[model samples]
Target chain A: MAILNIEPNIAQPDDFYEALIDMHRDLDAEQSRMANAHLILLLANHVGDEAVLREAMQRARALVPTSSDVSTRPA
Target chain B: MANVDREYQGLAFDYVRSPDQDARVAVRHPVVVVGAGPVGLTAAIDLARRGVPVVVLDDDHKLSVGSRAICFAKRTLEIWDRLDCGDQMVEKGVSWNVGRVFFQDERVYSFDLLPDSGHRRPAFINLQQYYCEGYLHERTAVLPAVDLRWRNRVTGVTPDAEGVTLAIDTPDGPYALRADHVIACDGSRSAVRSLMGLESKGRVFRDRFLIADVRMKADFPAERWFWFDPPFHPNQSVLLHRQPDNVWRIDFQLGWDADPDLERQPERVRPRIRALLGEDAEFEFEWISVYTFACLRMERFRHGRVIFAGDSAHGVSPFGARGANSGVQDADNLAWKLALVLAGKAPDRLLDTYGTEREYAADENILNSTRATDFITPKSDESRVFRDAVLRLAKDHPFARRLVNSGRLSTPATLHGSALNTPDAEAFGGAMVPGSPMTDAPGTMRGHPAWLLSCTGDVFTAILFAGDRGFDEATIAAIRALGTDGIPVKVLIVTAAGATVPSVDGIDYFADDDGAVAARLDARPGTCYLLRPDQHVCARWRTFDADRVRAAVARATCND
Candidate 1:
């Protein structure tokens, strides 16, 4: 086992989360998309494991709303 | 050290009546540069270095009043290095890469402008514009080919087939001069551009900023510090940067309604300064001013023999440190091309490439600064909401951090698809691509420590990279034939660690030890690169083709 267990990997996650939010703060649509792409590559490099990255990608996609899933939300 | 008035600089270049001072009439010069600022001085130096005599005229003899245009990007440093004053400026300048951003009171994150070492110069250096002006002025004074005239105001410009004639007004009186070629490096309100009825077209940003220079004995490290809605200023943004001479620059973004005169008053500025530096931070005022900028440019940089460079050619907001930096590059780009045309090395039509290449750089600087300005000063309610949301998210997530743009620090403009470049005949992957400034790599020349760019000194250079695969003497001699004693197109053979140097006169050999230089250039065996006088890689190949190399060299020099 690769020991990819989640035990609050980053200390002060709240602070880290705030910093991330600030980074994306004010970018236009095209820039925002590029930022997301760059962020993924950066984090993936840090993770550096094909299996772990695939698992994380799957988890992320599962949480994202599809077109069909969007109809369930309040208009 | 001087008076606190922001409008005047204590140091100035000695303004003497020009040797061309014919009070009754005019004088004819080979080249005339309008404006004695950094850009004009650079253009004059480049021309003089290439053997074209030049005369530089300026309305004022003093350095820019404030600590203006503080950040010198690496590419600009390289360009300045070729002009013979880069080392001096770097020695006196403070170099740094760390930039910190704060949202409200909490510190958000910090980023490195140049994360890696192993290069000739750093990512950025902070030096006052006055220091740069002083060094350039000193360098220009010693040049035999340049006649720098101060307090010589140009009032009119009339262009003709042979050249252009300028009407000047000096303290002694008015006179006229004819120039084979004229370069407008005048400041934003270019008299030459205006006289020629040329106008820069673009949107003028409504937002204004108050720039203040303060000096104190604080122990803060020299780095860029930017704040979004900082606690002291409440909703407005503030930026703090340290410059040479213990001077600190502070820029406060004042909305459209800011009272221009009122904001610059010492009374109004003191409270904010106190809050930002703490109540008792004892700082003496050096200079202060309010300014507005627009990201605008002329439709074309070249108008026959009367070409425009610097702020006269284009103007961008000061946020990205692009104004003076890009303008200096314009001077560099045009100097070599103009020199070639003047010396009959290339056809007159070659001058048109200057406009095309510099226009590309101007557009890039404008685009980057525009985006940064929009992000910094959101115009609409929707934009403000989005900005605040991003800022809020930026504090927490790495993804949000990527969206932050505090004026993406200036980088070298890649002139992709330039007309001067020879497009790669074969697919390749490497740093030294066609139309890109040649990247520096560590190596030894003649068995001594050196970098690749040091060999590219102010001439048409061909770097023949023959690694483990040895080169035949005939081929080496053939390449060497392209250069003569008078027409030196330096041909250097680069080989990795102890590869026997090919025996050929007039062919320089360099050892790329440890393969660091070769790998950096992405050069395999038999790779050859042709660089322009500006050290920009104009053409490259996987294998050497003697005839093809000759043609590429000709094309690069505008000889084809």
Candidate 2:
């Protein structure tokens, strides 16, 4: 196992998290969703645990309601 | 009647006896963009400025009504300058340099937009979306390379391997159009996106919001005024912002319980606004609407020949003004790439990178908006209490003040796995290196401001320190060879007493205290950092000469 530790400096977790939230709110819906997934992936990569990532993905997927009849159109 | 007949004859169309239906109108353009909104118009203008021929199609008979996005960030204005419309936008837009945040009934925090250095843009400008659209429309029309078609709607879009075929309904009649590529900038409910069957994935908040643009007379200071808890209403309150035209854009979070229809009543809205103002302020409503939006993004932005841009790709809560700005950025990202591909300067694989890069940016925005929404309207009771406590602490603690001042409410875009990222070396320890800004600096990268290499001699070199063993001659020669003519090259290797060995000479070397190196590089030993053009790190590697570094840089610089 490889461990990567990012120290607290100018870009702290609080600051990073808050910045992420702010950017997320500012984006449109399409960009926001992709941004959410990207953040999860980036943070997951930071944590670096496949099992944890799998669990988080499962939890996130569960949080989203399954709409079978919903159209999968691009809009 | 005879004089009128003479005048009408000049403007009248001559009717032919018989015409063949097989006659074709020939107009071949490199790219044909549909929808002349901010995204489409920006794309056209960017492509046209790049000397690429573009034809824009819009169904709108006239300019759009109402001001959609009134808050423009500093970065957005900078982009407008690139399009040569910054001065006009700034002149007509309201400047907001200061803002205050309220918690419960008290002012929890206040901050200024002026940072120490490095930001070349202002804090924010509040301009009407219509004005932005109109400005771009006017500029795009004058360009000979750009053909603007108003009152024309794309009725059907069909894409094949060769190109895209569009069925357009003009005021004249339905016409068939063909182009190499079609960029869909038709807002959130994009017809092209719908035709392609792409799904937008995300959460829709249950809470409803009412945005009212009103012209009112008040003694309020010219600052972004926010109320967490109005005395009359206990829950999350209103956000009042002054626009350019003496109109105040007020946003109220009317929870799922409120009646949206009744809330629209001027009688009900007037008193609530008066309560906050503490006086009978006369005002006329410009526009009012109750909207419930979900933070959703398309599963994919491109499907074969059709590419989605702006709201067609993603939608987020407008808490931090990221919605419109990000869309404009989408155009910025796509325009350059498309121009390169059309000019045969880069491979088609570069197009695939649009998804990788913009998706990362989109995700960042989503997280920021979600957190803001949660903070503004905490879901759980405990979370609300904690947030309130944090807000109170922000008043006294410097750390809290810094946190509040940084506008953590909006996340900056980070390029991780994009065309601009380079592979990391083992010594870098999988951390991102600093890149140069996108100014006319001697060594700045062309596309994005993210990437680590800075121009030294004839080649761009990544600065590195030896935590492992130091660089060898062969790798140094390779770095030199890679440094083609007109490209500067220099390698500086720094070795610390207890540092590990570095495996590559492509990086500039230096010898210093491990602490000092860590502070400068913002990383530890055995780490390879990838810097962007803006002196920001895009990616990093823990071990020296990681495989992904070269590939990332190659993708970024059109080398691959």
Residue lDDT tens for model 1, B139-221:
98789998988888999999999889999898888778999999999988999999999999997999989988898887877
lDDT of 2 by residue, B1-560 (tens): 25321232133222221111123863445688878888888888888987898877777655555567777777566566667777777887777777887766777777776543334355788877777776787788678888777766778887878888887776567777778888888888887777666777799988887888888776666678776766655776678888766678888888988799998887778776776666667888877877787788997887767888888899888777778888887777777678767877567766777777778888888877777777777787656555555565666654444433212434347564454655344343222333222221111122233212223211234454454655566555645654452222233344554555544524544434324445545555555544322234444555445235465455564656
Worst 10 residues of 2 chain B by lDDT: B436-445
- The per-model lDDT (C-alpha) reads 0.83, 0.64
- Quote the positional error of residue B423 for candidate 1 in Å: 0.9
Scored against the true structure, residue B520 in model 1 reaches a CA lDDT of 69
Candidate 1 runs further than 4 Å off:
A1-75, B1-9, B23-25, B485-488, B498-505
- Number of the predicted model whose lDDT against the real structure is largest: 1
Q: Write the per-residue lDDT of candidate 2 for residues A1-70, one digit (tens) a residue.
A: 1122324545577887788679778688766755554444346546667666676666657677557534
**DockQ score for model 2, please?**
0.03
Q: After best superposition, candidate 2 residue B284: deviation in angstroms?
A: 1.8
